[model samples]
Target: MALSRDRMIEFLKRHDYDPNTLQSMETKEIQEAYQEVTKKLLGSYFHLTNDNKSIKTNSILLDMGELTEFKQKLKDCANDVITLIECLQEGYMKFDYSEVNDLLAIALKDMPMHKMQKISHIAYRSFQEILLSQIATALKGLPKEEFKVLEEFYEKRRNDTQFLHQTIDKLKDPATRQQILTMARVKLMVVKDFMPSNLYDVYRDYYNNVPQKLELVAKVRALTGLYSKEYLKEMPFEELETLYQDILKHNEQEEQDRKMFLKYSQAIQESVDNNDDEGFNEICYKAVTHLTQKQLSMLVEYMNGQNPFFLSKFESVVHEYKKKLHIKR
Candidate 1:
């Protein structure tokens, strides 16, 4: 029941590790690596609790004695993992198992190993997202004194930015400039709560409008550049303002698209209930047009339990979209 070294190496590399280093490692070292990656992948959703203590999801270390045990656990515990993700995504972070009993039952049905692998990958990704969102929620719920501490740190970050602007002129070495830019990028965490009111408003808009959490760190990282200080000096405020306007326009369009999607989703549901193929096709076509790629992926996964007729319709719609958009799916 030994692990397939090839498969393990593939998994590690997919998560951005250097497979060469792993190749030379002994059994214990490989196990440690597996545990570390597993905790990282699961850390977000498993550790959430309604407590003052900081969340720690890393403690769920895998203890499979051999590959047989490992594969068995992956198969057996798959549904529970999916159920936990579903509940957390729905904002039920601390609910009892009874609440998800039916969902677990449905998820436990037989499936191909490859399909299970896909679900496992999705569950890991979804957990990471849920964890980030939970961390933001925790920050917002902090006590008044802790909240003030965040504000003070944010002020210090602003002062640091000014200092960097002055120092950038003196930093002639490329390496030093790069180091300073990295520090500045790390400091960008301050933006998460820098203007408390604005952050709250942004989160509110995200929840009310989008189906998923906005990846603020990623978005801000794009705004923060390599040699970030120099980039700011080179880019004119007029251009920056235009970029902001474009973001607003994109968000507005997304909202409109979601509205269209909802209308068609409801219409499709009614068509299914009434056994109306023509109505279903008409509504589903409209729905597919409004769906983002991410939404389409989720919809395909969700159709597993539905009737084959409906599932085929959705698959056809997704396939056409992928061809048109040149998506790799």
Candidate 2:
């Protein structure tokens, strides 16, 4: 979306530009004025904390009220970005270079040129701290060890534009890119506001290439309990689908086993409480076939400790069953 002339006029009006003055200016002139005024307004929130003679020049600080107001403005900007991202994901909207540039200009308008240049080294890293926080959230679920490495890397070379680009370029493989895109989409859904427009464009490209795969990838991740990028990169889509089905069957079988274990355990306990030797033997005999080896061992231990008679009866039943199996063979 391009910045409309009417939108620029409206913004100028709120900042005390006269309606008549704005109306007389050309669109380009109004845009330039808007940028200038926006910067000044944003910069007004900061005050120099150190004397001009001090060696440290970057001592800008915000007073309490200014900090509060500035935070609210960042929140507003974040909300707008969230909306734009949602629209882009839904295929109802697209972001142009000019619109993205306009958004970036507004976000960093308060910073000095040198600071802005360093921050803008990475297209996504150029936003304010609040927006960077959103990126952090999007990149969550990376293995903690890997995430720590990423954090350390960013902290070390954050100002090194060449290194950042080179690192990003290395992640050009489709599977790795899709993994990142999937994480961004999932995490961003829960985030309230603020993503850099350029980062949003990256997400847009993912959607354009593989619109339907995101949902399937999310489902496969949940089913297999695998969130690592390496896992996704190595597994093909067909394998993911197969693994999803296999996991579902395994889960269902486990659930059924849990229910059967509970049912037989209850029945065995009841028979023991009633002192019904016949019933206890019958329940144990039935349980042996359904329960796992560990479960049967536990039952044997419990029966032996609780009552000698029950233990004797259970052992007799097992012996008889084994004799019958040997005869059949």
Candidate 3:
């Protein structure tokens, strides 16, 4: 079976996929391939890297911390959030993570690595620990003259909203952010490629364990009328299956969610037509709702792993939907 290239790309990104390193490959060649494809998939966020680590640069608002400001929009748009909640309160929705990954990678290519690291609940924790430790350590006993360079970097990032959010009591110094990133690269330049599966597995466990949080997340659908943008940000597919199945047993699941879930399944029958691996990722992400973790994992794995990549039969099914969308467009 063909692994969904777009989906794989996203998984890599969310997992901090070191685009520069693949198993048994040169960093330059691997980075080149990703840089080329990312230009198409991610748009302009892609940038050349002198050192291996440092990640992407934030272009939109100028600071790595500005990302936290966007969260305000989500809260302020209560009606929108409620609409999303209402739909989800009714049934299980399936979403794919890959689409969210794509949206994020492209959107954040020019975004700060510090903020990007904090985007996912799972990744966010790591982002904070990693960046903070790097920065706090980098700043210890630094020379005053060097602070001039640090001052320049901070000036570029002083007004970031996301930064304020993460450091509600303080603003993350942009120079510190950048320097910490640089330091991280110096330490980790050699280690790259697929992240350890154990990290993801633990992420899945945390996601499954948090019932109140999951319910609250589902509320985001009702509150905003929009499903989560990233595919299962909290855990892996196997984790979702287990979580979803367990939740399904607790109560009578909504019929509408079932319908939406089924429709999503039909819509994403194949990868060729889906285009946005992240989009499918969003669907599968939503789909995991109301299932036991095992069930959620099983269903998602089946959707991503079992289906034929671009079978003619699947293509014909897509043609039918494409015609309708064409009319709508």
Q: After superposition, how far is residue 236 of candidate 1 from its true place, in Å?
A: 3.9
lDDT of each: 0.47, 0.53, 0.42
lDDT tens digits, residues 1-329, model 1? 33466755766787788877888888677766755765554343122211123223344433334423433433466657565445433322222223233233344456555664455446444644444433334345343333334333333333232222223332445554444333332222222423444443323322322322223323433644432433432333345456556676877777766675556556767888898877776666665775776665555454445555768777776576668678664
Show the colliding residue pairs in model 1: none
| The 10-residue segment with the lowest total lDDT in model 1 | 45-54
- Off-target runs (Cα >4 Å) in candidate 3 are 1-177, 185-194, 198-237, 253-329
Score every model by TM-score: 0.24, 0.36, 0.18
Which candidate comes out best when scored by lDDT? Answer: 2
> What lDDT tens digits, residue by residue, belong to model 3 across residues 141-227?
433323333333333443332341243223256654454444333222212233333433423433433565566556444434334
Alpha-carbon error at 185 in model 3, in Å? Answer: 5.6
Candidate 3 or 2, higher lDDT? 2
